[model samples]
Target chain A: MASIVWLAPAVTPATEAGDDPLLPPFGAELIVDFDLALSPYSEGSDDQQEVFRAFALGLHAGRRWHRWGVGLAVEGTLWRTLDGRGEDDWFGALHTGLEGSVLSAGGRIRTRVGGGLALLLEGTALDSAGGAGFYVDLRPAGLRWALDDAVVGFDPLTLFMTLPDAGGIPLVDVQYRLCIYAEFGR
Target chain B: MSARTYPLLLAALGLMTLPAAAHGYSLQTAVSDSCHERITVSSLDVLLDLVDDVSGFEVPDDPLLRQLLGRLQFPGTEDASLQVRFVMFSIIIGVRSPDTDGHSTFNLAALRRLHADPAPRGQYAHALRGPGDDGIAGDLAAVDGTIAAILDEVQTGASLSAGGVIADKPAYLDHYGVVDVPVALFAWHVGRALHALQDAHAHMIWDAEVEHIVGVLNYIDAVEGRLEDADGLAHSDALDDCHRDDVAPLVEAATRRTRALTLAIVEAARTRDGAALRAGLAPCVDDATDRDACGWIVYNPPCRAAIRAGDTDAVEAVCCDDANDFCGSPYAAIARQEAVGPYLGCATAPAGQSGGWAWGLGLLGLAWLGRRRRFAAPTALALLALARPAVAAEADEAADAADAPPRLSVVVEGHGSALDDRVDAAILSPAFGYGVRAGWQTGRWRFGLHVDRDYWVSVEYGARVDGGVLDVAAFAEGLFFDDYVRVAFALGTSTLMFDTELHSTGNTGVFSEIRPLGLRFPLGERLWLVLDPFTTTVVMPAIELDDRLPSLRKVQHRTIVGIEGGFL
Candidate 1:
């Protein structure tokens, strides 16, 4: 008698289950960042300090649980003097951090805050030129818009502080990123 | 509010707010101009002094001076325009003059060699002892060879002026329709010869103590990823900046060598005696060997007498100890190395003719791609057939249209850089380009192949060289708003070619283009006009002068307009 009675399984829609159609739980991003560094301890005349500019291209991967997310980012940055002097410096870094959506609008727009710590390795001819350092990348605010499987993000002002070896004073830089993420596994 | 327009707007706004600055050296006219000024001033002094010493008058009107000047076709000192023209002609033929980045003129082609030789012979007249080197003898021989080449060119020009049958003129002369081709040609060769001799003084270290040129700095090494191996005392800009306090001595030395070489060249031209040219270049040679040898024997006349008496022990005792002591200093060691074998000034052999051949093959491939239009129809039909199935279901829904949505289209585009004010005006301008794209469209997606050519002109040192960029890419586009708006992204490789006399050489790099806001307007049933407001192409490992000049990388942005015609 118990085996004869068959029951149907319950079905639930993704929206009803509090899942966002745009802000995917697992996704990857392609990022382009422009960095401007203020090296207070650089070699230059009294009136001027050697300004450094870097162009970075990167990949980011993360998994999200509701409003909180954890991610790992890897990027290669090409560094050069703003005045076009000397040779170019290249560096690669791996960043791991946590990000959370502070505000969301209709599951289409989200404002995020994130901070990451990175270990940077120099990739240049001169050994120890820009010594291997640890970087603290803090995004106090960022805005992202979702479009189906893609998300466009802009971090207007990101702060980077590098703590070099030998306990030297930290090197500070300001950066902005234009990111496009092709989301999957929503 | 379409997905296509949203990302496009965001990309455009982001690009607009990005900061940019000029990223390379200016045309480097300062270095070339300074070279010309030094040569002119020094030649005048040497000629005036020679004439005065011979005729007891402070004038350059002596018969010898006049004959030499007339034969060399030396321009009047006060005629600035003529002098500039003379220098320009010289630079055109003497150095590989068409580098857009200005390294050729700045380094005076010192990084390049006459041939792919492993020896320490640079385009600079300065030669160091190396494999296949004969020391000062080799240096003198190189100088003689350059002089011979110059005289040969002058003779050819003279013959041409005299209505002699010459089959071909120099390629560089095509742009300059000079009235006196003979004088222009002579000045050209002289300018070429003078550049090397002058560079010897600038590039080589002067030993004031021994009054001899000791060592030559290798600029090619300094800038070419071997900075650690390079001499710290000298760099690419060390002697180039004539006003630098440390460079004053080098300039003075260059002036002295310039005077010696000019006098010798003039004397040789007057007498047609090649020996006189060699003797003149001897003064410019590294005399460290003789100077070092004399240091031991001169003070100890007994050592000289012992050598005359064939007393080997006495000679070795006084001279060998002194030689060892002298070699203790790094400069003396370099000087000693110069006496025995090759010193460090020579750059390694260049990439050689293989690069030129590869460039030629690429050009031919591009030409084949351009000429084989007959294959376009079949290729388009094949692509359309492959794409038809994917859009077949959508096509069944729209039976009213004459043609299916999955049709092949060919687009021709004209574009120009939008970075005129954003980059260094001297280094780059808003150059124009043209391209073609062929693709198959299905539903809201299109995929295609694109070929583009952008022509750029580099003007420097009063000479112009044409350069170009050839881009070939594969792109994927998304159509939105009933196919009125489009956003396309492409990844491609670009080749930047410089049209120089030796060979067309260039750098090749990978690039990606994002056409953010492209509007397609219907002109007819099967034709449309495409306008892109912002297209950004970022080339990585950027295009620059050859590996010799590695620091210059440029990123270009452009706006594109095109016309597309559907087929099949």
Candidate 2:
């Protein structure tokens, strides 16, 4: 009887069964993200065919209800190069976004989409020097591997498009990121 | 928001874009580059002429002289004959090194670094004028002393050498401490002394009536919030621009003095006469009679009376007239009355517009909170009360209650970066930091102010980089597993200041720290030992990267261990 009891499946909470395994109901995460540009474009440069790369390190504080989550993230991105030419540029962005798993494969693999307005720091990306600007940062599609305490995700279709001022061309770039997230909370 | 306010808003925005007057000569405006290089090149020409006239002096044969001449002539060129560039570029390194990659490359990174650290006032020959002409005299003496040190080193090197051939011998330590046998050291010191001599001309007003340079604007006094004491003008405040048309006469005088000093140094080296060197420095130093006379013109009773009565024309006629003879008893009396004080150190103020945006955002956050709830009123009051030492002491004592959590807490910790992706281990050692945080705690939330200083040392070049971060943050924490494990999220606005070998640079940015795991152990009634196993800090617009290293990842992870104590 003891052996049978030990072998039998344990009862799982209804919320735990439906929720993403790695993320807590309420948690904070430190995210280290590496981004590779797909369609690199900059309004400041004449060439649009070059590659752009950036590393974004951020902190996300959020709460999750089942498969859907909302969070505020402050990300500092160090761009290796904006126009494939090796010049360093830095930007600090504050983002508010919603993330929800659209498809769940065995509750281990989840397809997610997240997006938000990334408000850029003033005088950072603005052509007029001190002017304020923002970018529409979107994770159109992503795949996440749920672990016991961490979530490793790959965002294949991340897009960043600047909301330009008058007479300014919209700068757009498509990037892919490998995100490592360490989460804590209930 | 109003139509009438649009122009004012636009004007304010334009004013924000206007560049502030820089310290010393404006290096960014290329004024220093142009003026210092021009004066130096012309001085070299004079030295060459003097050398040609001297019988025993061999310009081409003497490796030291030839090297000095060649390096000054073709600086930053491929032909490295002891490559010393312009006085601003080479010798100015002794006063304030330009933010370079240790190489002569001046890029955007170097320019940004310059924005961080301005030249220290009164150093580098930016002397005070008027009643305290002794400052300029002292600065010239220091330059003379440096010249003497160089000559002494040269003589010592000659004595130590086999046949008095000190040239092409390893005599002194270079910036990197590499033992390179070059004639750069002698030229470097000469150029360094000449820098001060030339600045004496640019910094002082060339009094046409007295036919002598007088009235140097005091940068130290100006920066110390003593503008009246500084003669109502700050050093380098739109006044010391070498390219200005009004500054043409001063620049010419600088050029002449520079030539005179250079010629004297060459002559001294040729004849090996210390007296000749002293004679050469005389042209650069302040004249005691002229200085005394000028002091009386500004400080005499009649001039002071006119100044007090707002009779500027009368004061100018009586005190500043060319033929005025107030250089007698009044000069002596005023000199005794207006005795100058000991020189104060450089200003600790940050050079440019930094920390303002962070403070603005913090205030805005408070306002937003106030609008959201009435509870913010007491919080704001508490923050204000914390500024007073006595109130803070009381708050600390009150927070030591055993029944409830502390209302006020303080934490002091020494933290070192456990992981750094940006630093090259071969070049630079890991950075270590110490910080203090103090604030009020209510329930599960803590709001506080923290100040941290991080230091980095270059193992290869022996250069030191110091950084300061001042932050106002709010932390939310939760305890689980019998109150043993704690997790906290900290969000703040951080103003980061960096003092590098080149200059000081700083930026205001938002920073977030997520302590995923922390262990707390009680030590006493009010004290606890807290160990944060994992703390990841991400500062926006990232802290200025070390120029000596290649740019890489910005995130730095630190393990912080500290003692937290609750106070009344």
Candidate 3:
């Protein structure tokens, strides 16, 4: 039985309530975001405040059980500094962790958190600060559109590293990756 | 036996009598009123002397047995004393006969139920019912003879079979009937009977206020034998409000008939006449109305309500309190109301207000359809038309049935920090800057990006020279004990971008930070205030001497407080 609500954008299936345990697995998502960064440690008295424009596309494959799922994601990220400086870079990270669907009906929100490693590749030349870097990722908001099989979401990805010491000025390197993952599994 | 041994025999049988005061209250007083003290004491003396003569056994005599005899003297409860004790004594002796098993006759559970917690409609009540009740005529009819047989067997040293069905192996029989039934066992059983009987005597005084009134009536019964005959105590104005007429007849009938009935059975037992024993015990057979004799016809109102409400724990507690001095369980349902209310959603918004959401959603759905952008108008119009009534009920149902997973939140923080001395001297000025952070929280962990920029300005050769440093780092955080406090470590890259009138350079290097403290405060259902403070270290990459850029490595400290909010 399906009932129409006046303000509802689409008629949701009345059967969705008891069928959550039987929903199909294997899903995908895409996301676009802007990241704001603050570096408190510098060589001198000047504090650093910078915003970066970034986008990421990730492919996820995982198995879903009753209410939750564990999966792996390989993502590509592109970021550019908005400090009026000519600098940009591209990198990739691998993430695997637990993700689960929450809320019922058309308001399904998915969340994921896990740790992995990242590598920086090309773009605006700043310095040779590239390597295999470890990082953690968290996706707080992932929502599926009504009557759609796909999901859209965004996450804040953090990289952890120790660099070779050069000279006097202190540097605080902060990087955030914003990506949308499209699920493709059964 | 010699005359001197007669007194000793009476003492060992626990039937020694003392002088009775007028209007005296106790089992002693009650027994003294109904039976001639010399006759009753001498009767027990003769019975025990015969047991010793026939069985060649010494009657057990100890201070503990004397103390038990004293405790059986229930003060101010005359109605239960003579008749109730006689019936119990007869039953205790009758069980020893080979015709019937003593264990079958002794229903200890039934006895305990009657004595301590009499239920209104049960075998216990029926057994205590005086006469004309089905229970007396049916299940309880054999109890007296059974107990008397048991007592007989105990005195005769008739060994009972061990390890059989419940009726063949009663605990009380084995315990008290051990080794030619000790005199102490008889005393203990008498005490138990007095305990149950005394409660029956005061059954009419259900409320605490009239308890003393019942005691006075019992005292009157002890001295006067019946309340029908007025005494100074009974005629007192203090009892004017008490409808004594209603209760007096019942007590009088039960007491008088039970005493007569008991004496007849004992006399028949003495003569060993099966026919007379059956005829003498006829009055003990209860008719229907006699079931109320146990005085548990009415239940406490709260206890009744709790039972009707299906609160078994409350009912158990309340009923136990009403039946006994110590309530069995102290589970108060009211105490747990608050904690259970939220989980069961006892407080839901009213129907009218909740139904409004449907109309709102319908209008929005219509507007979206009217735009002809995302969805076709025909499908949207159909949805809008059907949604008005359906949405109201369906939305409520969905909300009620939905189960949600843990939510995710984003936190944005900004704070100031100072760079260490290594880079201050190279920059020719002290460097200080502000760092900002943006992160998302998932369950117990937080992941975020942070960046800081430091600026230095100095006068070189009378001209203004300005320099800046920037650092970027990413942190992964974990909370302890699922508490609001979090600690995290960061790793990323930093670039020291410097430019003076003489030279400018961007030296990119490694940077890291340690987040030692993060305190969070929940603002509402989905918002939280977070305070995080940390230290960061920025390492610069190697530079050529020909490059006109300053090299720097430094550590900085910073703190940030912010808010996090999200949706489920």
Candidate 4:
């Protein structure tokens, strides 16, 4: 009885402190993106070329890139071109080299034009397919036009259309994309 | 043709005489009105079949007879309609259709020049004339046993496997031959048969089979969840085919043998204790792959006890099959992970693709026939429906959607092809369009729309010839049924159109679709699987030139029965 009474104080409400607000919805969410497309690809050649009709899906779990995060993307090609005789095959590649996007005028200045590394592996099952590639990407912040989500129309929402459009701003030729991330973290 | 052959000729005529509309057969009137040319051509087919039948009976050797009979034999489950056509095609073409086109000609001169003095063609006559044994009871028993064994295997392994293979354990480490085949082959067949059974009305009678599989899912899922909760284990290596195929999973859990991710169950089994084995599952739940595994397992002693007591039902209900695990919502994230990174292109190839073994042989035989003769005349001339009929077929034109305007869509689908281990450049092609789509969103209703289109402007299909070749095109039409996806059957037609040149044959090869009934699964908002069992009936315009060689500009009917899916 005595020990129970002695321990009661620690468990009592009087010792309680105020709340801690450390848990969620406030941190900057780091973001990474990858391209996941399989195809009888069109609008591209038999070589290692990136076809635009294809789009990207979230892949390889989201990785935060606000810190020192860099990405290398590689895409391979498989092709079997058919003429009267039979099949002639080739490959292609599209990649980039740079750091995140920048804040520039000229529509985010579409900074960091790309040059990707490539190789051609051949044989058959009669077609070209997987290839190896590596590249770096960078985009900067800039102001531009965008549609406001709330308005659901061309409300001319303000956008940070930087070279590497990461915040709901539109950019071109993304190594898939790394735009606005929807997360609980900041 | 002689009077003796007239009976068969009449029977053939009768079979073809079904009201074309009942089978949804149409006269394809849009092609030039080449009716007379068609009659002459069909009569020729009948005459050829009769001659071939007679020629077969002329053979005296038993061995040759048996071999031929085997070729013509129709095992149950195979489409008999196609079997009958094979006989007809073999008779008319002498070789196979494809062969006739490329290598062999079916003319008398060619037949006379052939090496064999007497082809054992009569073998089919003997087989077809033979009586069938209706041992329904015996067949039922066998089927029952096969189905039971299959279910038992699946039931035993469903707990042990993830997508037919044991989740991440190197296979070759254990007894290779014994373990692998059972898990892989047995489970695969069970799953396959389950699908087949569902397709063939088993859901109405044997719902238990489905229930059993779904029922057993609890324990396995429980274990999986626990394992996941634990800091993920290190045993995530893809097992070889052998290990993945059989009861190694049962053996692993039952024995607790671990050169890989063996459970701690067998340790208990050694003590003559199922309790230990039951407890062994705790590792999966409580002490799974990583830290999370420990959390789920460390606290669930009662659940472990329930499993140990051999009370699968209790363990299932208590641990899994609850709102958290059973409805498949909790693991959507994990499932997505598995779905995403499927090692690019090195996965095992799908069966019956491009021209697998049986198809290869079938095609080879067909190509042989194509090289041989003028089998095309009948298909080329079957155009009589465009004109006056001696017997008016009633079913035709009655079900016409002419008054019903269908909402049409033209889809340009692009998909990647695999060549061995590599993926190829995406190929984009526009599929022909035609369908009547109707959508009702809650209270909002949209007008019904009917749509249709040929693959290309021309109605001709897959025409091949000397110097001039027409491309093959795809077309589709939709038919809708009410409510419930399964209850609602979507009716549709696919047409492949192309053109070819034949001087003597009369350029009447129009609307010859080389495709058959197919099913597909949608992958994305617009993507879907397209699986079709292909069968084609060739139609053409017939211009009477001469009932001879050049007039036989050979028609080759091509059919591909296959399953192609993934991202439409």
List candidate 3 segments past 4 Å from native. Answer: A1-52, A82-107, A123-130, A146-181, B1-568
What TM-score against the true fold does each predicted structure earn?
0.36, 0.38, 0.21, 0.18
Error of 4 at A126 (Å): 4.8
Candidate by candidate, in order, the iRMS in Å equals: 22.3, 21.1, 34.6, 31.4
lDDT of 2 at A139: 44
Distance from true position, residue B104, model 1, in Å? 8.0
Tens-digit lDDT track of model 2 for B1-568: 0001123323532211111222444332211234554566655655544434433222224433333344333333334222223222233333232222121111222222222222332233333332232332332233333334434533442233222222332211111111112333334455545555555554444454323433344443443333343242244433445666655655666666566556556555666665645544333235553321122111233443565576767656544322232233222121122122111211222334323343355457546645863322223223322211121122333234323777888888877652221211111124567777776766445676665665543322223444545555666665332223345667776665653222225556666765554545456667767766435565442332533211111234556778888886
CAPRI band for model 2: incorrect
Give candidate 4's whole-model lDDT: 0.22
Over the true interface, candidate 2 deviates by an RMSD, in Å, of: 21.1
Give the candidates in order of TM-score, highest first. Answer: 2, 1, 3, 4
DockQ for the candidate 4 complex?
0.01
The model with the greater TM-score, 2 or 4, is: 2
lDDT of 4 by residue, B1-568 (tens): 0001123322532211111000000011112221111221233232223322221222222332223333433223144343233332222221111111111111111111121112211101100000111111111222233334323433443333223231111111000000011112212222222221121111011111111111111111111122222211111111111122232332222111111111121122123333432332233452344421121112133443565576766655544222333234322222222111111112212332311332344356457655954333222122311211111122122112212322332233222111111112111111222222233222111222222232322211111122212222233322211100000112222222332222322244343332211222333322223322211222233233432212211121121111212120
Q: What C-alpha lDDT, on a 0 to 100 scale, does residue B131 get in candidate 3?
A: 20
Q: Model 2: runs farther than 4 Å from truth?
A: A1-60, A63-145, A148-180, A184-186, B1-23, B26-33, B50-183, B209-211, B220-232, B280-363, B366-568
Fraction of native contacts (fnat) of each candidate: 0.00, 0.00, 0.04, 0.01
> Please, what are the lDDT tens digits per residue for candidate 4 over residues A114-181?
22232223322311222222222222211112123210100000111111110000011112122222
Q: Give residue B264's lDDT in candidate 1 (0 to 100).
A: 59
> CAPRI band of model 4?
incorrect
lDDT score of residue B119 within candidate 3: 27
